[model samples]
Target: MDYNKVKEGISLLLEGLGVDCNDPHFKESPERVARAWTDELCIGLKEETFHLTTFPMTSGDQPNMIILQHIPVKSICAHHLLPFIGEATVAYIPQKSLCGLSKLSRVVDFFARRPQVQEHLTSDIAQYFQHKLNPQGVGVIIKASHLCMEMRGVKHSGLMTTSALLGCFLKNSTVRAEFMALARLQ
Candidate 1:
């Protein structure tokens, strides 16, 4: 929200890194990075962007499992301020209501845009739909490769997987199994 402050801070960071801001190529770099962070990476911090509209189920509507898979996950690692890229699978069983199909992916993007650890991001998205929809259950699974780990210490190239299950998804083995199967998890 404070564009000027962010620009100033990024300028200071460039200076601390011994980069000359006066250089032709670097002159606008601070403003550009600051704007990119606010407009892209930190967009989720704004509450207005999280509005999820739901539709009521009719008598003809049957309660069933709904799964959205291969939803892209792009987030910054909170610890090292690096990037993590992956996909997420979100599933839930209806309980008298259903949200738009695209809303599931929007929810994922909402949390992903914030600087966060994969674990918390998984849990937050699960909790959001669980609380908002009061569904029979909610399940979330994420698989991502973090730049922090890949580009630094140990330099190991490995994917990290995390999952969160709530309500029936947590209590019922069959339900959990089905979700994981649909998500293509081993």
Candidate 2:
């Protein structure tokens, strides 16, 4: 993305919102926001590579669920241009392939950097694993706080939104329940 152009746009937007650009506190806000977008808030732009490998089945040929829980997620809502901060829980039953434990978190980070809806984001991660890993099943759940809702619109600060994608998880009640139970664990 064009960082300079974005910085300029933020400056213009702040000016339009009647924020004093010359004020000491506000003068550097635009640039700082732009840097945050390019670095932290939008780091998914750099995650274009998906490294996959085939590993020998070490789980004794039993298709056990692999769950990664409470992965911190932060993204911008496409509709409101506001922050959506949350935690994601993902699970998949490997068929004959498996990915590194950390790779799952990287995949989550990859999609979270873009502006998106929570529903779409949840489904995208599940779909990616299903398609790429060809797993027996994939599940994704996200619970997030949208700044758009908390700061404006209804202004309900305590409201949290949840979205989930259940592929094989839905077809099998036991698997679905297990995934949910693992996700809720502290």
Candidate 3:
């Protein structure tokens, strides 16, 4: 990300909005926004360096779902560039391999760092696992509160959006139910 470019854009945006950029309080706002974007909102770009380690399968040849729930996600909406914050529940039934628990979070962050719609984000994670692990099943669910909706437009409070992708999880009702049940619990 080009910090200078973003700073310039923000400066112009503030000027367009008729905000006094010369004011002491507003003078550094552009730089600060650029810094915040690089540090917090856009940090997922760093995930390209993430590497998953190989580990022995512990499921003893029985395909079992590993569900990680409530993984916190904070992202910017592509349409409005406003914040979208929420939880992601991910599950995969290993075929012959499994990733470390923490690596799953890294995978989530890898995709979350980019500007996205919730539907695509959910599907992307599921597809990543499907391609990488070729797992027996992969399920992903994302529930988020979009600041664009809450802080603008309709301005409705407590509005939440959800999206999901169920792969092999879709073929078996019992597995799908179990995944949903796990996501709902606690």
Best by TM-score: 1
Q: Give candidate 3's error at residue 185 in angstroms.
A: 1.1
* Global CA lDDT computed for model 2: 0.84
RMSD of 2: 2.3
Task: Give one digit per residue, the lDDT tens place, for model 3 in 44-146.
Answer: 7655666666565774566788989879888889999998999888898988887888878878888898787888888888888888877888988888889
Among these predictions, the greatest lDDT belongs to 1
Q: 86-177, model 1: which lDDT tens digit per residue? A: 99999999897899999999999999997989999999999999999989999999999999999998789899999999999999999998
> What C-alpha lDDT do the candidate models reach, one value each?
0.93, 0.84, 0.82
Error (Å) of candidate 1 at residue 70 is: 0.5
List ranges where model 3 is wrong by over 4 Å.
58-61, 159-161
Instruction: Kindly report which residue pairs in candidate 2 clash with one another.
Output: none
List clash counts for every candidate, in order: 0, 0, 0
Shift of residue 76 alpha carbon in model 1, Å: 0.7
Q: In candidate 2, how many Å is residue 30 off?
A: 3.0
